[model samples]
Target chain A: MRVEVRLFGGLEKFVKDVRFGEGFPVDLPEGGRVAELLDRLGIPPSQVFSVLINGRHASLADVLREGDRVALFPPLGGG
Target chain B: MGKIVRVDMTARKVTVEEVPEKYRLLGGRALTSQVVHDEVPPTCHPLGPHNKLVIAPGLLSGTPAPSSGRLSVGGKSPLTGGIKEANAGGISSQKLANLGIRAVVVEGRPQDGGWYLLRLSPEGAELLPADDLAGKGTYEVTKICRERFGDKVGVITIGPAGEMMLSAAGVTNNDPEGNSSRYAGRGGLGAVMGSKRLKAIVVDSPSLFNAPLKEPERFKAAAKRFADILHQHPVTGQGLPAYGTNVLMNIINEAGTLPTRNFRFGRFDKAAEVSGEKLAEVAVARGGLATHACHPGCVMRCSNVYPLPDGRVCAPIEYETAWAFGPNLEIGDLDVIGELNYLCNDLGLDTIETGVTLGVLMEAGVIPFGDGEAAIRLLKEVYQGTPMGRIVGSGAAAAGRIFGVTRVPVVKGQGLPAYDPRACKGNGVTYATSPMGADHTAGYAVTANILKVGGYVDPLKPEGQVELSRNLQIATAFIDSTGLCLFVAFAVLDNPEGLPTILEMINAQYGTSLTVEDAMEMGKRVLKAEREFNLWAGFTRADDRLPEFFTYEPLPPHNTVFDVPGEELDRVFDF
Candidate 1:
């Protein structure tokens, strides 16, 4: 049930001064879509370019589990 | 013609040499590697007096060529103990070229205890005592250098980290706005400069000298067509201009190869947090530069700026740094990452290496994973010379040792960039085989259909990865040596005539009729020469490998280890 939320790149402003997303490894309230987690992080769905959970691409409805390292990256534009 | 500027630190002497006869065929990486191999002793200690640091502009530098302002800094890497070349974009290359200087060589060691700056103008070269600028960060040094040398002179300087000779130290270069934001940020080249006891190098823009152009009309015609190809390409023109390389964050994550949590996973769970769309949106809202060029005349303009809280300027955070610092270590704060980007600029370090190493430390629980504040403190507030900061700054291999973590992914002494080889097989070949260590740019072959290689293939394909990596690496070497931007490869490869156009431009500039195939051959030779230097430096096949962890611990999502056969990976020289 626990999901530790981490954000990166240009997305840190949403979490106040917390540069690294450390909302604690905790249990999720229930099953929800990726959109719901975005809401939790104050991110709009429109702003999300890519979403993956535990090294796999995730849909909003991808179920969360305990101790999942939920990592997020800002949009990538690499040379 | 541009000449080589040589400075004898030991004797306080300076001289300029004409471009050598054999080197007439080379530029960029090719020129740098060839020069280093022939001039420097293979067994020379990278940090000792025998190791000379040479900075060379690409073949196309000093011309009105698109994305051709890149300069290569080459020497034996203090970190890798091999021939190393870290390239960057700034005003230095073109300015140096304009001044009729082909390359600048800093040799021997300075006996003077005080730090000094090298000033090169159309008049000549001189070493100035810069005791006042010692220990200053790059930004402050640039401001002072600009005031003293006038704003037109290009500058390359180090930060406090470089002064301390940290292994991660990067050489900072001034951006178009005169900020010391862009860097040749890899392989600890700054430490080489630091070893010479030099603080900075100031270049006065030269107005008169032009490298002889063989056939000006043909070059112009070809350049126009090449620029057109770039404009027409989707990835190069549209995606890059709109989102920059950060756009790959989402796409690569979608493919499950973003390399999160210190190589523990191939993808991040919350990738959307820093996806390019999100970055683009925030950049729009916060007055951040949406997309810009790192160098002038760069039509691709993949580089962009990220603003501070009040929309004030901060260094534009690149995707490699973002992924390494963002998801790999489990941190998702963009501003913190941006601040770290700025700090790395000031500290004169590579963001990707720093981030990757920090991820290793985080995995070891040196500090809690995803704690951006802790990461910040460890880098900026805490002395990097301290045990903890040194562990992080020494790069991933060293940090992995300190943390007792075995999942370190590095080749040679350099840390891998953001791509996860478990998912992207061709890039895996690149990571494994590149002479430049674990560098993504060594051979960045995206989907064949994506216009980079002028065809499309499934990203998951295992069939053509070897050839793909081989061809791409050859092409990249050619591009890098020409001092041309690699992003231009996207556009050139897409159109059938793109490569020819590039060749046409080069031949036209040099007044030679060298064919495109010959250029490709030059590319191969550059890699071979660099590899030969590495071999001479006492590296072996065992050094050309991913760590044991990548081979054993199957990464998540795909549950795939680096599946590239060791034999096939080793045969990357099969061209």
Candidate 2:
């Protein structure tokens, strides 16, 4: 399965050679969990506080499908 | 013990009174709202002699608590015509607290059409005629006050917009750098100050963090722990310091909730051009700072200094200002956004209100969208106090009414801020229900709905939105009363020991054993008092609603409308 993964806030530090908002294509086995993608990207599970799948909040345990727009963020907030 | 200074503008007399026992525990928004609810008649005109302006430092303002130097200015809003408590991060609050002043109440409008300046020192406070300083902008007023008094003296002043009694004018104060951009920039409190003929307030105190504490050692330990909590949290410690609040531009755009071009779109094609990352890159390249503190004793330091292309500087252009002038207007230039923000700071207008007004003007074909130079020309008219300027300065609701633009984003005559309610529905609940009139800070559900700070709530859903907004509003009311920056909540919400640590600091300072329950109760009390004041001012549940267009008009990208039921909004205060 192919998914687009983006990082925001300080989470960009985990993935080298990528701009802040640019999405990187990642390939995962069928019925892959969000945690597997984070593991593949070298992101510490504790570091990523927010995960959004297609603009909706998602958890690490959530199953990922092909063509999912997944975004991971460090523990971050502002207004 | 702190004293309350009462200035009778009509009588031209200043008197210091002992803090009444009943009011001794209150500070910040609690103190201001309590005074306004008790003293001012609900039906009185906001600009009339009957409305009193109450300024207060929070309970922990002059202490060693990190980021606790916020000042609250409260009155009946000339903009919203309801109880208002607008606050700012500046040096004045700490100085006022160091001088043992709990609050300053300005009562009775001046009969004579002359302006006065209030000077506060270790000796006492006095009123002096300031007619010479009447027509200046806030930047000049602050500069003059700093030069005439002392460089360290905190200057609180209004600009020509306030002098003209515009509905969107705000009360501004100087930061440590003498930038008069730290403002209680909501609710037209500056117009209320202008109505009293009070032009400027110079606060002179040798002490910075000198609010006396009952148990200094205990307070110190608690404050240290609290600071550590802020430092340890990634949001407060890393993200904010990296790019400041404007960091949200890209994420919000990615989430499809950025409210581009006055809520017509959910995303901007050129969002990255005005994003925080771009801002930091440009600012540092131009010999400016990407991170600075708004006030002393602030550990987060989520502020920036952006040097403009014209050899000018605008400090701390936050996310909302960037959005209001950038994506909301279809302008992709950061310099243009910085210029608009700088103009609002000098003219003493609320940037949110002014930007929304400009968006309405564009909607009505008064100006073209994405035309930065034309927008600049219109804002100059505001500083000049022209008829068109007055219409624009009156706020987005008024501009919409005058121009017959039905898509104006506002609640209770105050403009909606950066977030699009149709997409971020929890914030929509907050906008529809809060007494503060579409204020995002009143109940920032974005923490959960989008940022996933405390917990996650779906931004695109109506389920659990009322509950999310209600809890956040209660928590935010408490945080605002404590004189801490709202940004601290990002850490405190995520940390389990956060609330108790803050309570420990308060108890150590004031010698009171207040628990978390008591703090929550205080939050409820403040909201109930404000709601009661609005009710007395003839606001019904109908007033506690988003604009009708929000429900009917579906925003793009997500194709969502604000479907949170009005009954759910009413139930926000049921607790």
Candidate 3:
């Protein structure tokens, strides 16, 4: 299965050559969770604060489907 | 002791009076709101002689408190027809505090229709004829004032939009860099200032952090501790300083609550194109600052200096302003957002209100969606005082009425800001109940709903929203009074010692033994006074509601409607 991943708020620093909001396809086993994706990106789970899957809040254990849009962020806040 | 300067515009007289016993403990919004409530008649016309414009600094504004340079401008709102207190970040608050000035109250209309400028210095206060500065943009006015007075003087001014008494016109002051972009921009306070024939206020003070403190050593210790608390926070110390407030664009977009196309949708596909990361890239390439402070002593430095392609500079494109002009109008370009932001800063209009008004105009087919050029041309019409421009300056609610647009996103009479209420229900409760009318800062539930700052409240659900908004609104009211930047809440909410440290600083400065409960009580008092003023001004429980469209229209991504009960909204102020 393939999932689309994007990083934001300097979380892009964790992944070389990937800019903010730029999506890249990642190959993972069927029913891969967010924790596995973080490990695949070489980003520690502690570094990423919030995770969104298909625009909904997801946890580390949430299963990812093929063609899912996943966005990872460092703790960021403004109004 | 501090003094209050009263400028009687009708008589063209300026008088300085000692701060009253009742108002000695109050500053910023607390002082301004109290002055407005005590002096201005509730039933009077907002733009008439009966309304008074009160400008005040926070309690710790002139102290060494970090990010404590907020200014509060209060008046009966021409836009909302209710009590309004609009806050801004600029050097004037600290200057005013250093000059021993508590509040500057502009009262009565000018019978002769002549323009004037109020000059405040350590020497005295005086009102000078400002006919030469009349009809100029805020940027030009600030520049001219800086040149005439020393460059360090803080000039707070309005533009032709205010001269025309447009409801969206906002009062603006300059940052330390002489960029007149910091605004008390909401509820049409500038129109109230304009009606008084006051074009600008030039504050000249030699000191910044020399406000008399009762216990200088204790205040210094508390201030140091507060700064460390801010530095230890990830959001304040790291993310904000790196990309500025515009950093929230991507996170909000990802959360599926970024109000797009004038709240017709939940998210904009091109959000990242105009986001903080992109802004930082473009600004640095153009020799502009990616991170700057709105005022001195601000450790967060969440402001940016964005240089446009036209060689003009918009000091900081804040998150709400960017969200307003970018996703709300369906314009994906940063330069366009920068241009609109610059125009608003120059013309003395609230960017949020102007963007939301332009969105309503687009909805009315006056301009097409995503047409940046047309939006620019229409916005420029305000300088010429065109009929269409007047409609634009009249704010979102008036524009909606003029064009018969039923889907206007407004609560009370003010336009809704960046977040879609349906998706961010806690903020929705805030928008519905805040006396200031659709002001997000009144109760920023986004901390909990989206950012997980204080704690997590389900953004998509209505549960635990009212309590979140209520507590935040109370805390925010108190923070606004302190004249500290509301951004401090990012750290203060997370840190256990935040509130206590703030109270200690206040106690050290004022010699008051206030507890945490007393701070909470102050917040409630401010809100109660504002609510009572609104009630006397004819606002009922029905006025505290999101528009009908929010209730019926289901936003995308989550397919959620604003489900917070109306009765619950009324309960927001039950304390």
Candidate 4:
């Protein structure tokens, strides 16, 4: 299955050949969990604080489907 | 340890009195709110002589505690027509605290319409004629004050917009570097000050951090631990210092919550061009700074200095200001945004109110969307007090009324800050129910809703949002009283030891055995006081609502509307 993954707030440093706010395709197994995708992208669970699927908050245990738009971020805050 | 300096503008008399026993323990927002609630009538016209402006430092101000120099300015808000406490970061709070001042209450309007400056030192405070400093920008007023009084003296002043008694005006004070960009820039507190006919305040204190401590060793240890905790937090220690608040530009844009072009969309196509990374890159290239501090003793320096093309600098262009002027107005050019920010800083106007007003004008077709030059030209007219400028400076709500635009984004007559509540529902809940109308900082649920700090509450969901905003509002009210910058919440939310250390420092300083529960009660009491005042001032549950458009209009790209039920919002203050 193909999914789009985006990284923000300098979390792109953890991924190979990725830039902030840019989404790239990632191939994952059918019914893949967010944890597996993080594992595939070499992102430690502790390093990432937020995961969003199609603009809604998602957790690591959430199952991913093909063409899912996933975004990951380090802990970030501002007014 | 505490004295209230009462300055009667009508009588032209300055009197120093011992802080009454009932009000002795309050500080910062708590103190200012108490003063306003006790002395000023709730139904009084906000700019009338009956309205008093109260300025106070927090309980832990003028101490060695890191980032504990925030000042709170409170009064009847000309904009909201209710109780308002606007917070800011600058050197003046600590200076006033060091001088043993609990609060400065400006009472009675001047019968003579002449401007006066209040000069304070260890000896005392006195009102002096400021006619020579009239009609000047805040920067120039601050500069002349600093030059006349020693350079180290803290200068607090308003600008021509305030002088005109515009409801969008804000009170500004100089940072350590003498930039008058540190402002209590909400609720039109500057208009309250302007109505008092007070032009500027020069705080000449030799002692910057002589706040008396009961247990110096214990307080020192606790303060050190708190500073360490702040440093350990990645958001406060690293992400903020690297790019400042504008770092959220890309993150919020990606979350599809960045309100673009007057809330018509959820994302701006030119977001990256005005992002923090771009800001840092350009700022560093132009001999500017990407990170600085708004006040002394701040460890988490998230402020920035962006030098413009005209060789002038706009210190600390915050995220809310950036969003209000950039994406919301469809003006993505950083230089133009900086120029607008600089103009607001000099003119004593609230940037959020001003930007949101400009967005309304664009929505009305008064100016074309994305026209940066037109926006700049319109903003410049504010200084001249032109009729058009007054409309723009009257804030978002008034601008909407005059233009016959129903899409006006405001609550309780105050302009909403950067976050679009429809997409970011937690912040939306906060905007609706907070005692201070439409203020994001009142309960900044963005930490959980979008930034993924504290914890994750789905930004688009209605569930768990009430609880999130409730807890944040309580915690925030308490933090505002401690003279600590609200940004410290990034560390406090993540670290279990954060609150305890802060309490230990406060307890050691004042010799009060206050537990976390007691401190929380202080927060609740502050809210109760504010709510009571607002209720008396005629704010109902209907007034405590987002604009009708937020629920009716669906924002893209998620196509979500603010769905948080009003009954759930009422439960926010159930405690």
Q: Against the true structure, whose DockQ is highest? A: 3
lDDT of 1 by residue, B1-575 (tens): 56888988888788888888888777778877888998899899878899888888888887877778888888888777888888898878877877777788899997867788999887888998899998788888999999998986788998877777777887778877787877887888888898888889998875412545777777777777877787876666666787787777755665677888888776676666776656667777887777877767888787767886755566577788889888887877778778787888888888888988888788788788888898889897424467666666678878877668877778887898877776777777787788888888888865451222455443445567788889989989899888887777766766778888888888889877878889889988988999899898998888777777776777667777776678777788887
Best of the two (1, 3) by lDDT: 3
Candidate 2 lDDT over residue span B330-384, tens digit each? 9999999999999999998989989989999999999999999999999989877
lDDT of 1 at B340: 80
Each model's lDDT? 0.77, 0.91, 0.94, 0.91
i-RMS for every candidate (Å) is: 6.4, 1.6, 1.1, 1.7
Query: lDDT per residue, candidate 2, A1-79, as tens digits?
Result: 9999888766777888987778899999999999999999999998877787887778999999999999887655678
**Per-candidate clash tally:** 44, 0, 0, 0
Return the candidate ranking by TM-score, descending.
3, 2, 4, 1
Q: List the candidate numbers ranked by lDDT, top first.
A: 3, 4, 2, 1
Reported per model, the fraction of native interface contacts reproduced equals 0.31, 0.54, 0.77, 0.46
Which pairs of residues collide in candidate 3?
A: none
Best by lDDT: 3
Cα displacement (Å) at residue B519, model 2: 0.9
Report the C-alpha lDDT of model 1 over A1-79, residue by residue, as the tens digit. Answer: 6677656545556766655333445345777556767787787665554455654445566777766656555433355
Model 4, position B41: C-alpha lDDT score: 97
Candidate 4 ranges beyond 4 A from true positions: A1-5, A13-19, A24-47, A59-66
